[model samples]
Target: MSEGLKRDYQLCEEIGRGRFGTVFRCFSPESGEFFACKSIDKRLLLDSIDRECLDKEAKIMQLVSGNPNVIQIIDVYEDDSYLHMVMDLCDSSDLYDRVSKRIFSETEAAAVMSPLMEAIEHCHRHGVAHRDIKPDNILFDGRNRLKLSDFGSADCFSDGRSMRGIVGTPYYVAPEVISGRDYNEKVDVWSAGVILYIMLAGIPPFYGESAADIFEAVLRANLRFPTRIFHSVSPAAKDLLRRMLCKDVSRRFSVEQVLRHPWITSGAEGRRDQ
Candidate 1:
């Protein structure tokens, strides 16, 4: 632990762990409040790019911290061996957990997506593109409000500028990214579309036994709403999905457009009986 972090917060039991860091439930004695302390080992960031990405993670989070749908960072600390970030402690299961538990109705899916899109919209408006937007990165606070986190894969962009590099989780990556082409923030919309599809259908629109197969499916961008699974979903919902998952970037819906779509604007009122 960083000496500064050690003196500031009392670290508790491990609550989560990732490739290069571990998240612990910690208490800030001064504030007398709980927050998650994410400590990343400096040694693990072996390359310059790795360290740069780590730095961007905090910068990007701070840039978008104003949004209620995004996690708030309280403070950041770094020592010779580790970098620590103190953020709101959201102990509830992530969006992935909720999706795995059961399929959600169109209304329920909308409830989850409404905030997420807003968060993305806020990020885009600020020039950041969350290269990664999978369910695992979507967390909930004690109140169950969505809080997008984990900016290790996020980057900033300006109008007319496209981001390079192949980033994002396999199941939710946009086709342009897989194609090794320059892309824009619309990639986030594609990933969110995958999440929405899984929410209403309980399965990813693209999948395979291996990552390569999954990437192939993503590049193909063949979308479908199975009769059995989508028969009950509203046409407006399907239309939104089609526009969102469109392979042609020209035809894809922007975050603002998606927000205005009929299904979303209609309050996503769906039958629970489905």
Candidate 2:
């Protein structure tokens, strides 16, 4: 490690690891502040696209630094063998782990979704599309306020540019993404809708034995409400979900429209069974 990149921080156990890096819990000795240090191995940079993605992610984090609902990227530096990013340490489990334990009530769902919607809107306004908006990317603070994370697959929109790459997780990908059709910010909205569906229903709307099957299911399946399972779910909730999951990107509701939906704005009271 380079001396300039070295800092006096107590390195604790690993918090998480992904394809490109490992994250550790660390505490600053001088400030007595805890942080998550994500270190990406330099060896992974052999692939030019991977290196570009890393650079893009770092830049995107820098661009969105001031937003409270987005993860704060405190510092970035390169060591002799790795790139390290120091970030705000969020102690709460991701939305995925929480939903796997129990389904969220309408009020609980709203509380989580409200900040998430704001974060997405903020990113959209800045021309960044968080192509991957799954439950694992949504982290909670001690108060259960959500902060969006994982921008490795994010892309900035430019007119006349074709979004040709295969990105995003199969379960949360929009219909157009699965079909290999050009898409835009609407893809993120589709993923967000899937996240909301999982929050309330405790499972993804489309499921299959394999990735290809999942893609096929997503492209062909009708957006069906599990009325029998969620007997207490309000009609407005169902209506909003339907509009969001539309296969036609042109028909899908925008994030702003979703925020103004009767089910969301009226609060959970309107979503409770009468």
Best by lDDT: 1
Candidate 1: Cα lDDT at 258: 94
lDDT of 1 by residue, 1-274 (tens): 7788889999999999998999999998999999999999989988999999999899998998899999999999998899999998999999999999999988889898899999999999999999999999999999898999999899888766889999999999999999999999999999999999999999999999999999999988889989988888888888899999999999999999999987887778744357
Clashing pairs in 1: none
Model 2 whole-model lDDT (C-alpha atoms): 0.84
Error of 1 at 120 (Å): 0.3
Give lDDT for model 1. 0.92
Which residue pairs clash in candidate 2?
none
RMSD of each: 1.3, 1.8
Model 1 residue 212 CA deviation (Å) reads: 1.3
Number of backbone-clashing residue pairs for each candidate, in the order shown = 0, 0
Off by over 4 Å in 1: 270-273
Candidate 2 per-residue lDDT over residues 137-230, each given as its tens digit: 9998777667899999998885645475679999999888877777888888888888888888887899889999899889985777767767
Worst 10 residues of 2 by lDDT: 1-10
All candidates: TM-score: 0.96, 0.94
